[model samples]
Target: MATGDAKLILPFNSAFSSSYWMRWQTPVCFLITVSPGIAAALMLYRLKRRRGCDHLPAAATWAPCFRGVPPLVLPVYRGLVVISMISVLYCLLRLNGLVEFYFYTQWTFLLVIIYFLIGTIISAHGCWVYYRQRRRQGVEEGNRFLTFNRDDNVDNHTALVTADNNSGGKLEDKRAGTWGYCMQIIYQTCGGAVMLTDVVFWCILVPYMSSAHFSVNLVMGCMHSLNLLFLLVDTLLNSMPFPWFRMAYFILWSCTYVIFQWILHACGFSWWPYPFLELATPWAPLWYFCMALIHVPCYGAYWLIVKAKNTYFPRFFPHSYVSL
Candidate 1:
């Protein structure tokens, strides 16, 4: 092949070569993979400081206290930072005539980033509402101050509190406050947005038309199935009270998805959903396999971050009186 042909083939060809796969995937993969470890460290740090702080302050407060700006400001600032970086990179790629390559992958990659940006805004607004309410109640009485001690070993804490206990001995059900209601709305809205986006992308934008010369439905369907499994496991991990049980569930879910993918591939079907995986070369399967491996770790890190935030951040934890 000529040099131009080689240039065209390299990325796909390198996918199958173990050494090349490691070199290109490791940097970003490692950052995403270790995110959970970083989150764990942060969680421990927060726990250590929990005794002195009454209610866990909003993430926004910690951001500014830890840095110079308030924590709420950080997400917006970070979003702008990401936009700036993408803009700079886009310009550089345009100058290099690599912009066309980006267009091919933009449907999925760009949309994923956009979804996160929107989700972050919703989360920030929820945090603001939560913090304002906490401020009104005063810190000492706030629920944020309660911290889980690893050494406590109290099994009774896992018992489900009844509506009566939650109501402070009152028989009537308490009404949730404006902030609490708003937070629930935001959570449901974000979840809906993600589901809608995924539907459009998988069902419409990337659909497998009979004329397209490939089984788009099979590939996309399998990928979406795997994604659903991931989402289910992630939700269970976050909601489950026992950490060990959550870990076990996650492991089992991951293995199931991996096995399903292999079975599909061995049966002569393309199980990878991403459009980039549609190539005919041997490299295509290998690349998808690497991606599947990388996806679990990246998502696990995200789960850890979200779990820690809800546990350590005041805004996410619900209050008893607020319901009234």
Candidate 2:
């Protein structure tokens, strides 16, 4: 039966000859992959134009909803950084140094690490600002107490106080700038990529498609599980908003990987990391279409998780937790 199965399936190839393009499945598969990518790009463009840069609040980049302090989320982000880096390094060493980075699992894992790294830096800055604000606030209160009811410098003092208050308010309300948005885009992209990577690996690939090229092992298990686990913890502790519009970026991430795989094969590198991604099969179009559509649910699952967090956190921890 194994030999019969091998005989029935088309062998993997590296070169894309003229006949390869001539096949109906080839063009259809290309269309399936390219169409979503184009649509996602346009959707992101329109969203940026319509919502403007300030749509994602700056406070969310640093602050934790469960607590009023912006710095409270720092430890969680730092832990994520350490764990993700160690997991990624272990996978690379266990599999095949740099070559293992070719898998989407590595791509998503690296992306998660990047998000946490950026989050940690931003959180550290938030902590500094938080402490500075506290010190200034104490000094201001002391000054007010000492100068209470003084009429000697009333006008000058009033103007100076007003100016100082305005400056502090502006600083506190600072916008999330370009880097903040970049961090957010990566976070949301990782959300979907993590889900897709795990679901495909555990549900479909493990059951039906496992082989020598894609073996089941501890390293691979951690690659799928830890990505989801870390991100979930982040989602719970961090104040970042998970907007549905950001799903566009996730689609583009997956599409970019597909294009990368296609390019590698065109350059004579045979063997797909995931069998469903092969374009040579007659069912290629179906696989491509299904993969493209799967992004919705994969993304939706994470979005729902965020929604659930926001919904139930306040109810459960009424005193300590607040929704983002």
Report the C-alpha lDDT of model 1 over 7-89, residue by residue, as the tens digit: 21212232343343344443443343344445545654665476632222222121222212233554564356346435633
TM-score each candidate: 0.30, 0.82
Per-residue lDDT over 1-324 for candidate 2, one digit per residue giving the tens place of the 0 to 100 score:
011112123245555544555677877888899898899899878766875433554556776665443455565666666676776666455445566666788788888888888888777776565556557676554233112233443221111122266465322123577878898999999999999999988899788863744456556677678889878877887778888888989988888998888777766666677778877788888988989999999999999999998888879887757433
Error of 2 at 200 (Å): 0.6
What TM-score should be assigned to candidate 2? 0.82
Off by over 4 Å in 1: 1-77, 89-112, 142-324
Which candidate achieves the best TM-score against the true structure?
2
Clashing pairs in 2: none
Model 1 TM-score?
0.30
